[model samples]
Target: MSKVPANEDFYKVHLLNEWSWKLTTPLDAQPHTIDGNHIFEVIFEGNNTDTVCANDGHVELKFAISAMEQRNPRMPRLKFVRGLSTQFEFAMASLHTNFIRGRFGLQLLFVSNESVIPGEDFRLESLFSINDEVTPGIFEMVNIKLGERDNSTTSTLKSHSNTPQSSWPTGFIQARPVCYTSERYREVKASRDAKLSKQRTVLNTSDQELLLPRTLPYLFYAQRIKPTDDPHEVVGMRLQNISFGTPGDGYYAHSSFIVWTISFGFGEPPIDTLSPLLIGLITLSAVVVLGSLLFGTMLILIFQRRYRFGEFQRLTETDTTSAVST
Candidate 1:
């Protein structure tokens, strides 16, 4: 295959550092059907093309990214580099708190063509066979809000993490590898093992607690759909669904690549119950209504004053004319 050109079509750029890891098995995005306060489902279909290789299998997992934002006011944005890539790996599992579990062996595929070309948006498609081996795992989709007294980032992560693993609303447990076996597949495994070990150090840290609240219940779509036009890219997610964090409680909102969307708040609330977004909307509407009424009253008073002055002038002129005639 010829080298894919970096052109206007790409909207995102993958800044891979020296320590970055890549996934050999590609993922596809499934369609979005259900909407809830704290749960989402994205199904992906995996594919395995190469044959006659040893590592033949299909696998899938439930993945989610913590929404982290910058502390600088002028530069509020989502931070994708956690010394980790945004792609979720499902194989080398070490239990994560709550419902989500991550594998140390997953790699992410980034877009070569960044342009937002129609039918060209990066997508996740169905995962399929690798070397004819079957992968395992049941994936459940869930959205979680922060708990009381939590930061936007922390609240979001805890909301999801608090859910019992046994209660994973949706996820995958795969026994088969989701890719085709190739002669060079062994190298991929070795690289994955090393990467997983390193990531384990980071994933097991307290810094993994940031999250934006408006996008609360961060939705995870299963990896089943792939970008149709470019194998270099996949399209399935509706970028329009991206939203800013609720600004009601002095929270700021913004967008970022790798994580796509994120939001922040000043302090933590009963995230599980506090709907700052809803409260904010109500407050804004009330302000607008009140302002409109005040403005309308002021306009009416001004017009009434003008009308009365004109009438008084007319009466005075009539009296003067009558006196003069008499």
Candidate 2:
């Protein structure tokens, strides 16, 4: 019989497997523009080996931007979306300029896909931190804490006793944004309720509202920086935060993520004296050319009429002279 591996060896193997799931972004050490409509792309690749394909799990990615400190207790939480493939891309147009200028936190949560059993309770807690100063376009993900739990594990096993079974982990698979202001909170809640109503036809509506926690207990903080001298210049961003579950559970965690600031300058060019002056010159040149052509045409017509009149006068004078000579 084969002997079981020791704890150290087991953890090492697990790490190796986990490392196989690679996260990649297109920045390549370049700063991201803070311009409102930047496109961010992230790719997740996994080996199709048995260990990685234990249950054909998929990945979900989420992110949020918040100030380094919350002056308002009612800040919105992160936004999340499930990835259908290895590559995930989204536009950052929704990011508010005021919220992005300072030291803000950018939280990314990754989750594996799992079946949701009815009547089961699940929970998740995640935290990450940066080990060093993150410069514009330069940062790394370190100290990642990703965990989940499900209460219906034993019952689900019993129900599938006679069939082939594989253990699957289940828990919260998405992030919910927390809005600080009452008006914003109401707006978000109404949007969510509307979405839930539409999804009720296809999914269990009872649990849809419970998928995300209603409270904003965790505070995400970052160090704020001054705006750059140039509006179009890119800047560096450093983010830090602590996230945990209910107190006394000792599940607290901290993590850091970096964002490169970029600016695409989406609006029209700045209005300047030179622009107006050039436009005026061009308009004046066009008018002058048109006026010259009109005057030249009129002169030609006048010259032709005068020349015909002179020819008629000479013919009449010549006829009068011949008659007088006869």
Candidate 3:
């Protein structure tokens, strides 16, 4: 197929660096790690083949992860997936997320791409499947106020993170990868490993606590959702400094590519400005009310001044003096 000429028809998510994913079969017992001999490179954009993807009049971005699996790490521009020229659409139609609109969907599918050899140089297998259900955080518009604190019907996890969600500006969303599970453990695993997963991280986000009468029962944290230039533009997410383990945390502390789901806050972008017609109407109403009050007050004061000055003459006094002669 000819290359789709690069244009603004879609947005490209550029990464700071190349990231890789490795899996160990029988990860608990006899371990054999398969690095896949490929660096992961993916592109994202709105699925606009049929018209711009939209939802309830707002633009909905259905970004698909097109993984360009390469056999040689040095061949950065190599575009090959399962021996095909095009990259595999790993998680396109199925955008998996748990928290948004109090609903969730299984928007992901991946089966092992068997290598020519079983353990050595294994290439990951993939299938592009759809589940018909609307994928959570797949560019759905949300309009919840800062604390939706009165949201009892919302899930317990709707407010589970340590970030001050109440202070999260409008159009901010956490495209949290709810969970990563493998029917067979030989491939994918949870991004968070043994220690960090269980680690009780309690950030001191007492800024809101200062506004409260007393302390709140919540931990404080940051970086739960990545910030954006257009806070109300309803953007998805991309990560920098990707790694399996940090120099401090050591290797296997985390999996870089597992949680790389690019979903955005599902909500209505803020309507900061009122319509011009509405504003004009409001100004007119205010002027009319003020004018009526001022006019009434002036009339009342004038009447009081005349009456106090004894300016009222009786009707019988209006008769002319010539009436005496008649």
Candidate 4:
């Protein structure tokens, strides 16, 4: 296992063998934008090593695997894809976007040439804080939450028993949501009262019908509010309330709108969908370039052979003319 980086900014995260994703929107006509160009770098050290890494350049991996897991979950086994250190980058893009409905969902696709290990799915809850400030809900924002397992022991075992050996840990982690409303703006603010404090309405009314992720059980969101005279005006007075976390089989799996995406990959050739789509696009582009080179080489060879034959005929004709003159 690699030592945890000393810098506080380098947070530890857990990646499961499975992949999951989600996207949410505002309740009304709130402004919103989503860019899924995030990257996940997985470094593997093990007995069978065949990985790719670099001191400065981007490390290219043949196949990568990742999944949503609670706290820093344990990965007891890892395979090296190349002789060098293995690193990877995953990209994000979507088929479409919706403003009126205030809802968006992420699609999951994985590709890998390596075998995968079993693991748990969880949210990275440890990063959420109560002291973070607030921002007015005028538009929407989207961010990624990297998860780390709370304990290494809380993972799947390689036993013959069909039943689970132990229960999963307590919490899940989540990234902050984009809140747009009538009032102020504060970044990275956490609130204890996610629902009652200053909850932002989901932009899409239709999305109010969907369910949350099955792995996340709790629901926590923040809001910015201005006190008013009427007690019942809590919904109107608050500037923003952004939803964050939910427990497994809880309100999240039952929520109408949720915004998040998961990227993962597996081990082996003919990479599985488990490989991220962003990566797939890159591999496809490479194949096209190689094909073009092969075709161009064949055309050049044919033209060269024809020119040589024509030159040989001209030489023969000149030789015959000289012989006739003599």
How do the predictions measure up, each by TM-score?
0.20, 0.19, 0.21, 0.21
Q: What is the C-alpha lDDT of each candidate?
A: 0.25, 0.27, 0.27, 0.26
Model 1 residue runs over 4 Å out of place are 1-274, 314-326
Output the lDDT of residue 119, model 2: 41
Residue 104 lDDT in candidate 4: 22
> Worst ten-residue run, lDDT, model 1?
192-201
Clash tally for model 1: 86
Residue pairs clashing in model 3 are 94-107, 112-125, 113-124, 113-125, 141-267, 142-266, 142-267, 142-268
TM-score of 4: 0.21
Which lDDT value does model 3 have at 189?
30
lDDT agreement of model 4 with the native: 0.26
Residue 296 lDDT in candidate 2 = 100
Can you write out model 4's per-residue Cα lDDT over 1-326, one digit (the tens) per residue? 11235674433211221222222222352224312322223332211111111112121122222222111111101222232212222221121222222222112211111111223222122223222112222122121111222223433223234745333112111222431111122222311112211212221222211322222211211111212343222111101222333223222222322222122222221111222554677678899999999999999999999988887534576666765433
